[model samples]
Target: MKNLIDYKDDIYKCSRCGLCQTVCPVYKATLNECAVSRGKFNLLNGVIKGDLILNKNLKKYLELCTGCNACKDFCPSRIDVRDIFIAAKAEYYKTNKLSFKEKVLNSYFLFKLVLIVSRFFLPLYRFFRVNKLIKYFENSIKKMGTAAKWLILLNSAAGNGYKPKIRSGSSLKKVLYFDGCFNKYINNETLNSVKKILAQCNVELVTKNFECCGVSYLNDGNIDEFKKIIEKNLSKLDDDFDCIITDCASCYDVLKKYKDYSSDPKAVSLSDNIKMAWDLMKNLEFEALKSYKISVHKPCHDSYEFIDLVKKIKSCEYIEVKDYDKCCGFAGKFALINQNISGKISEQKAQNYIDSDVDIILTTCPACLLGLEQGFAELKLSQNRQKPEIMSLYQFLSSVCKISD
Candidate 1:
């Protein structure tokens, strides 16, 4: 994985036709020659053929990508650009070494340690806008010569946000909520809404401490770190709950494909579980949900599975938008590291929904929520109009459905 020469053949297949440029969010945002796949491909090819060594410029080009898979989606030859970049990072880190911040971020023990330490300062941290302070810290770290500052900032930013109060209750069916690190740290509203929806279906929510799903690290081509975290997560489960649910599409996508030594049953996404639960509750009579213009933003990871469910739901009339599976530009750290490109991709998705005139835009992933909201807000600001509300499928269903004990 550390050898750049190994990918020479794989990368040689790239035609450099610039199809990737058309779909690349960062390229669209920065307009820099190096931000697009074509530019990165040329750089990597040069390195592989011994014309150039892995350098800061190469890293910058690699880092510009969000690993969102859009270029791969549109590529004629279907080269794995994201995976290739991840491999490049692993190769680069092997020789240049990871910074202390990256080393800490890459270490599960340290990451969890920071989360524990941050919890104690939650009130005061919120009072002083600690997250904003963290942004400055990361900026300083990057300025002080740490390549991993962006990663630290993302971890710190995720830590600064609100957490959900996991409701305690006794119910018939017990569930293990695989609260991915970010959802637990930042987007607790999604967790609460999911819990409320599950409760309506007579399900009890429970969770044991779980490790990061390692999808982010996987994108970095750190297979050792990815496998280490995956194993750590598998060990924490005692197998008491019937079903496991996750709200993050990326986490769900990763965990569903998780092949640990233990071979635990695959985890289900919250949307899939919700659709199943909704089917069980559909027989119960309830007043019709009010009709309103609504659009469903199906994330690329979960869109195929969710599309059928979208078609089957009766509560809200579904309005379809073109290219609904386009990446929302928030593939975890993609937007943070490549803000300009991410913003453009996000704005495009937002415009799709706005043009449809949907009252509420429903999506499943938290990243999509942020990307869509940011896009909608920017578009709204541009037009001097209001942005549409964003809601999760589970959250929307929980608001409308009635539960019978």
Candidate 2:
């Protein structure tokens, strides 16, 4: 792994342009230059020059980022801002001793344990409206500590751990399906939909004992753990498959960037074969539906041309929302760390969908689904209006393909 100083040139490559400010979700919410890429770059540059120390404040600046890559995407210089931040985070973790709370939150065993418990109690949790309960718990967790906040967020995001039974097809082209953590646990409907859609395409969908994509580890600055999980995942996949497909945009983005973080040859191979589920299904034949007004919340990590593909669908009328490309503010642990900002951004997105007056609000990312759902749920209580149904693109396509859940 490269150190922060190794990316000295990339850090300095920032032209100090403020265009990132316009698109940065955190910056838009906080209106703090320190929350944006350029400001962070300046701080990083200061650290390199020995003018500033990698202290708590400096670390907080890095944490303020949602890692959405919007700044990198909009950068005139095309600097990999997210990459630099990740490197900086790794360096900080290396030099500083992690608090007990940080260590516990980042523990693999604890995460898996929480997942197991959450899955077991999912029915009861939903019955009590756990999503609604999270808002109230947020304040108390903040008062407790950062560790509590992590626990609350992870609990809130836990899914029912439903596994869809996907029957194999007779196609020679084998596509390995990587059901990301969110889809695997909470949103199995999306996975089932993907399987049915792929079956229609005459492609064999394969699955093996795969682990989490280690995105949460990466976001939490646990690079060592992230690499370990990625190595485990790589061992499960082989070159025999035609392509590796993922429905979650964030997972797709992280898988695509695996090569940059790890030197493992398999990481490069795995990333090379990664295909966004929407990219594969858009060209396939499906029965068109009656005209329905639909709005899309494009995930910040969306790299494929899914929106254009959605537009190509004949039956559904795509309603355009103002600032459609804005972040839904569910940047993994970011929503937990900065709930106020996250809630504000999510509410703004929900308002856009409400204003569009659509029958359904569709998104490509699983985490975005949670954010949109929470936002719409809050809107329902406060505004007393009908909240549009939130569905994954896979769900929408499944309906068009007439796949029963």
Candidate 3:
């Protein structure tokens, strides 16, 4: 919960290197210096010295970021750009009144209500082409000057009810599995795949009732809600397990931050045990399936360990795209809040995959799956080209391991 003032030194550490311009997805999309870290840092520095005031324009400039941490990684000084932006966003929200739509979207109760309603009515909605109705509603919401178009897009992309059955195993090594909000509500096929693969490796998997990792809340500048959910998750996550596993790269990133965000001793232990499911799968011996060329979309939070695992699969041919490590422009809420910029970036990534002529496009993050899907859909309409199937690394590995559905 550090304020912008707390990050003054970190802000000044930026030497206006402009190296971030080369890696920043939003900056590439908008070509606005304010969209990059160095530019944002300069504005923030001015705010600290009372030369500039925090206004709607400044807030919008900050919101332009995708929270991919690319600038932080590319910085010569290794300045923490994401931390500063997040803190500044939190501070901005503290003084400003949240809009009705923002409050409703970030409310835990409303989220639960929407999840329940979607699960119950999604089939009917899909059958009836509810997106048209949503579009009509969007017109009204837009008239109200709120960004409800994101809600419309999200509703259209909602998955059909696909819950995977959880299986247990008897093994010496104990692992707790954290199914992120996307896996828990929209799709569980990937979670089931993780369980099947882990069972094959003789690792016992444990399940618990965990809340959203608060990454969404943090992105929305709802710090209070984020803290509330984190405390709840920490209470449920005890130190009994040898490792806490997640297939979602975003959840992995957020869970690892709990150590710095909280004072609870379990927070550190839980963060320390946060392991990527693919990291475990890489070492296990498995018979690779029949050969198929595949391209990977490495998630922003990924350490590329999953890419190495994909390469190890026996008969499969791995095709590398030129922008393999670039952001898919779907950094959670970033896709929703900044759809135009997000769509432009996704188009670039998707076009790269389409040009590769790979049979499948693989990624580790569910959000990326949605983003890539959106991109392919847009391209398919414009170019009328045959698009490759987008699958999760878990799904690809499950197929290679021949795990039954």
Candidate 4:
């Protein structure tokens, strides 16, 4: 878990090829050389060589990256450029303590405390139009040059309800839910839907006493804190489970970072398990999903091995959007911190949806849902059109298939 800047060999191995430019979403939006992997590489090299100090201005350039992993996927060297950037941020944050906001975010106890308080103050948010108030607070954070965003988030927990908790039965098939912070807070419905889908599959769910998946902490470059959270979660999860389920791609990707699982024989995302079960059900001549006109936003974390599943389902007329594998701009903190560039990448994805002529836009992760929904909102405003509905792949499946008792 060394700082990404510490990857001298990987950083030095980068040939400044600029091949990452073709697919980098931020670079496409801002058209700034500094927004892509190569530029960031050069900047980090300067910092390492003492040509540049790791200051806020320099940090902002690194922060502009979405950590979408697109660059690494395309890199000939496969240098893991995204992880390096994340490590660099962690290294920088080590030298520079957490900002007032980040300090609150990284603490589980404080976050839960804020959630408790939010439950009591729910009406106040509703009375004043909370979502707009949140946007106002986000804007205010920018205007006042203060850490109001974290304070606002502290107040806004009840707006989405508390971090979702799953109730488990004593003895049955167990499933672990990797509820990343965002899914716990914003996309509670998907959590609920996952429970329902599990019930239909006859799999009993278990709620592990776990911490956040550390994706946020990892991106913030608080590696030590991130490691601590993962270790704590690993200690709590001693029971056996059929599989681990999560509704966020970024969280799913980060969960794999845990060395504790290096020994576990089985671990898979909820969608992955479903895709496997889907094959079994298909062999049974189960009714195909016929009512929906849908398109899938294959998350970057979903194995490319599953792309054949897409091909299999394609015969049912499930529309596939072009460039669907590209990141949806929900790289945790990236969406919040780099709004304009993030929005542009999101708009492009939304535009693909509009052109696809589908009733619903489907994705595997909750963050993608939020990012795409926001993009659809922007597109609607621009064209005076209504936005398409956003749905998790589970919800889409649950809607089409009836659950048996």
Global Cα RMSD, each model: 6.9, 4.5, 4.8, 6.1
TM-score order, best first, reads 3, 2, 4, 1
Write one digit per residue (lDDT tens) for candidate 1, span 1-405: 335567777699999898898877778777887888889989988888789788655776788876667888899989878767878877877767676756765676776776666555554666777556755544334334223433443433343343334445667788777777755544455666667766655677676667778876776656677767766777776645455667767776667545521234432222133222233333333322776666788776664655555455556567888767777877765665666677677778888887777777777776677677556534534334455667766566556544333
* lDDT, residue 36, candidate 1: 82
Candidate 2 residue lDDT tens string, 31-70: 9899999899889999999999887678888988888888
Would you list the rank order by lDDT, best first? 3, 2, 1, 4
Q: List the candidates' TM-scores in order.
A: 0.73, 0.86, 0.87, 0.77
Best by TM-score: 3
What residue pairs clash in candidate 2, if any at all? 159-186
Which stretches of candidate 4 lie above 4 Å from their native place?
4-6, 97-110, 113-172, 180-187, 260-290, 305-316, 381-384, 403-405
Between candidates 1 and 3, the TM-score winner = 3
Clashes of 3: 0
Query: Ten-residue segment with the worst summed lDDT in candidate 3?
Result: 138-147
Among these predictions, the greatest lDDT belongs to: 3
| Residue-by-residue lDDT tens digits, candidate 3, 1-405 | 689999999888888869999999999999999999989998999889999887767888888988888888889999888888888888887877777966776779988777667656666775686756764454344334224534544653554333344355557687899986766665567887787787777787787868778888777566787878889998898768778899988898889888877889988898888998888776675545677788899999879877877776667788998798988898877876787888889878888987788888888888888778656544533334556768888876765555421
After superposition, candidate 3 runs with Cα above 4 Å error: 122-169, 380-384, 400-405
Worst 10 residues of 1 by lDDT: 267-276
| Per-residue alpha-carbon lDDT of candidate 4 for residues 90-180, written as tens digits (9 for 90 to 100) | 7787677567766675776886675456445555665667755665444334334224433443333323332223345443565666655
Off by over 4 Å in 1: 1-6, 99-175, 199-205, 238-243, 256-288, 380-384, 402-405
| Residue-level error in angstroms, candidate 1, position 251 | 0.8
